[model samples]
Target: MKRVFIEHIESYLPDERICNEQVEQRIRAGGFDIQAGLLEKMIGSEIRYYARNDEQVSDMAVSAAQKLLHHYPDRKIDLLIFAAASGDLIEPATVNIVQQKLGLTCPGFDLKNACNSVTNAIEIASALLLNNSYKNILIVSGEKTSDSIKYTNIEKETIKDHFAAYSFGDAGVALLLTTTTEDKGLFYQRHQTFGEHWNLCRIEGGGSMFPNDASKLVFSGDTFGLKNVIYEIAPPFVKDCIQEAGLTVNDIDLICTHQVSKDTYRMVAETLSYDVNKIMQTFHLYGNTAATSVPIAYQQSLLDGRLQKGNIVMLLGMAAGINISVQLMKV
Candidate 1:
């Protein structure tokens, strides 16, 4: 297979910054008594962002993609992929909207895999770039998770299911990938899904199961059960990826991850005996932006100089559907 290099990467976070106090305020607006500092304490996210009411998912994606398209004005995109767990519509794949909004003539499609959507897109695009004539593929993602929070109906029994929602933040990320003759690109990637645990996390409405029920639109999940599974699978799972890549934890210069909870990186650091500084902890700052989590953190690493050209970076992801993936690459 031919090497696939990331030509460029960028992110677009909404202007409206939200702190844990704001999150608590909104929840309290429902006239419910909630423990203060619960979100930051449990989720470890001090701040997250929400797009304005008029902003759509496509808008965010286009904003991110525009940065790349402008950076390389002479380059042409042979293909485009919109990968995300959030979108502006249920009909007409989000990729179509993104392509149209960006005014690109390239063929495009949508890919969804809960929080690992963008990582999966990169895997697919790498294969296509290796085999096909296309020189470059652009992947973009936007998450508007704030739209799904249910502040009003906070029954104590069902509270367990909604805590995960508080950790969610909105974001957009874009990556431009192309075939490379050099070694700086994706080399090893693996994904495993435990479908039986799919019921642990979900947005119950907007699908055929509960089509007409608006109340089912909010995020709901078994947090304790999900964490149990994470602990069981993630440590061994990550060790496998690093071994298969013919590298050790020290060989990995940076770790970009889809943080499903506050303890996501904490678990990785403890299980692997790797330095905590090597891990990118976006959950505390950006919250879980679903599919954008890993990519945005990857972008931040580049800007912060923690990762540089030819550095070994691991894209670690754990999403709903009980999905987990590890992609080792050079940047």
Candidate 2:
């Protein structure tokens, strides 16, 4: 069977930078009880980017895909997958928009399971590559989480649900994968979704259950975002992923877990008994970029020399659908 390898990866960020201090001041000056420097300590991100009003998820995705194409000019991508926690529109899947924007004639579609979208896309793409379904696959994700936030009446759930909202940031990520007969590729990949906790984190509105209606909208209170239970429920699955990969915690050279927050990842590290230093993270600089978190951190790690060729790396993630996925790759 042919193996799949990540030929190149790239990420794009908006120019607008919002730091913890800026967000805190903005929230406090509006007569909220938000404390000073609390977000930085609680979530662990110093700064994050906010997309411009005109920019949507597909726009950022096109930018990232363009960069990936430029980097690997010779390769031909036969399949395009746009995975995101948030989509651009309600109908006509967002991947269609991305495919047209990228000017790709190949087949395209979307895979969404909240934050686990990209990880699952990789799993699907790898299977296709190994089975001779497609020669080259392109996966891209763009998240505009700042657009989903509701900042009013936040004091009601101040220390509870509202706090999780402040940690969300925006970003776009692209990855190129192709068949490689060499021994280095995906050795083991595993995924499982625990729907019992599906309601733990979600956007209840703007869907079939609660269609978007201005008359029925309520913004001040939990207008649909993550809850406090995600951090509590997601850690136990890390060990299952490790065991599935046929490796112990120590065997993996670097682990690129989901970028939820500094505190969340630290708790995950402690629960799994893995070294905190070995966990690659980009949340401090980018906060939680939804499905783009793991890929962005992976790209940063490759650039910073923390991850190198022939290293065993694991990508573990948990998303808003209360889903968790772990994939182990030999780079």
Highest lDDT among the candidates is held by which one? 1
Residue lDDT tens for model 1, 1-331: 4698787899999999988889889889986678997876787756789999999999999999998889999888999999999988998999999998999999999999999999999999988898885888999999999998879979777777898888778989899999877778889989999999999999999999999999999999887899888889878988988888788889999899888667888888888899888999877788879999999888888887787677899999889999999999887
Per-residue alpha-carbon lDDT of model 2 for 1-331, expressed as tens digits? 4678888899999989999998887677656767777887777756899999999999988899999899777778899999998789877889999999988889998898888899999999998988888999999999897876655555554436446667778889999998787877777787766676665565667767678664222212231344345555556566776776678888988888787667756766787888898988678788878899889888888998997678898888777656778788888
Off by over 4 Å in 2: 29-31, 157-159, 214-236
Model 1 CA deviation exceeding 4 Å by range: none
Q: Who wins the TM-score comparison?
A: 1
Candidate 1 has a TM-score of 0.97
Q: 22, model 2: CA deviation in Å?
A: 1.6
